[model samples]
Target: MLQAFESAAFAAWPAQQSLDLLGWHLRLDRGYTKRANSANATAQSLPLTASDVQAIENHFRRSGLTPTFRLTSFAPIEDSDRLLDACGYRACDESLVMTRSLAGFVDGSEIAFAPDAAAWLDAFAHASGKRGADQAVHLEILRRITAPCAWAVHASDGPSPACGLGVLVGDQLGLFDVATHRDHQRRGLARMLCGGLLGWGARRGAQTAFLQVVAANSPAIRLYESLGFEIAYRYWYRVPTT
Candidate 1:
């Protein structure tokens, strides 16, 4: 699972495009570059320190980039939160890392994976409240998906309902960006899409699959936990001060 997490992080880093390491804290230029995004600090065997945080902040400031930090799988590090508080970095949000073993995932039904980019974007916009310039972010995501990487999307009848994206890395699957249109909620489209992704991962020999969800999203958390996923870790995001 650790290796899989690292692999996913590295794969995502290129999209962010550049990175710098400060002990355990990875600071990315140009809005938290891709390389730094891949740093699974908490997943590492060693612990991170306050100096690491300072180093990353220094690197970001020197690079003339806004200081953004993402702590992945960042469990308790001795005085980690204190360091952030000392450095003027405030907690932005927290997310839960949920994992599920795929030993019993079965391919029960065929869910139509979205093949059209326009349709996928429409669904994304409806679910995420992101439109206009923010929609450009989907282009990078589409590039990754159409690169023929392992991804799946299920649409509803008449129009596309919700969408789920999953990426497979070695023996694990990373599920990301599961969104459902407001009107399409309560119909279990998200579950079907998630189940389909799990099935896809299982077929490819993924023993476990994991995803991150906002800690405040109780519905999503409940769904995942009910599907046999457990909270593996909690991560927080923060931005460094000048």
Candidate 2:
């Protein structure tokens, strides 16, 4: 189930565009987010040979985007990590994929379900510190979600949206781009969004929920632990060590 969520989450949060080369997904979105611009191993059927590595590197370099690889535990290629090491790639942003069972309806007060991309985009930009084309790519990504999406904002305090998140995917309720605004750091806005989203999921027939956060983010990790989330697996980026 964790593996299923891993793959489903990737599909839920797609790039502005994508292409499959040699059975691997090459995601692109003007280099906005790693998940968008990296070379994904989720669907690869071929082995990761040195030649394939060069091809992968060349493919992204041709478009001025750094070649990146997201290696999940369930990746089709088993020796991917070793191969990347031979190719001089180093790992970073080791993240934990966590999940929990469905909870009752969380009072999702001030959590506005977006009818479209506009409201969510504004909140996303502020929460994630995106600007210019970086921000524009986010909007484009939001439009690509085909599942029953709920782009929500936690603004019970006042008119300003304090934090935001997009719950995508299906019964798994994949959470993506969850961020809190700078001014709302110590508050419990993120906690609200998670519980509320879980309730929203229950109402929509979702049985479980999942999200990924950097292992280095202790605060976020602690928060998730308090919510009954446990480590399902870990993933990280393999990039040129240079």
What's every prediction's RMSD, in angstroms?
A: 3.6, 2.6
lDDT value for candidate 2? 0.75
**lDDT by residue for model 2 (1-242), tens:** 65578567767887766787776778876887787788876644466888889998887898889999887766667677789988899988888899887755455544666557777777667676776766676777777777878777765545344545545466778777678878777688888877777777778878778888999999999998998888887778998888
For residue 94, model 1's alpha carbon misses the true position, in angstroms, by 0.7
lDDT of 1 by residue, 1-242 (tens): 45455455455323434443533435343442233432335444244476776666566677666555566654444465566667787766688878888986796756666666566667667665667764565555456442223345564456566777766766678787788878768888888888888888898788888887889999999999877789987777665554
Task: Show where candidate 1 strays beyond 4 Å.
Answer: 1-6, 9-14, 18-20, 25-54, 61-64, 72-76, 116-119, 141-151, 240-242
In order of listing, the candidates' clash counts read 3, 0
Give each model a TM-score.
Answer: 0.80, 0.86
At residue 117, what lDDT does model 1 achieve?
58
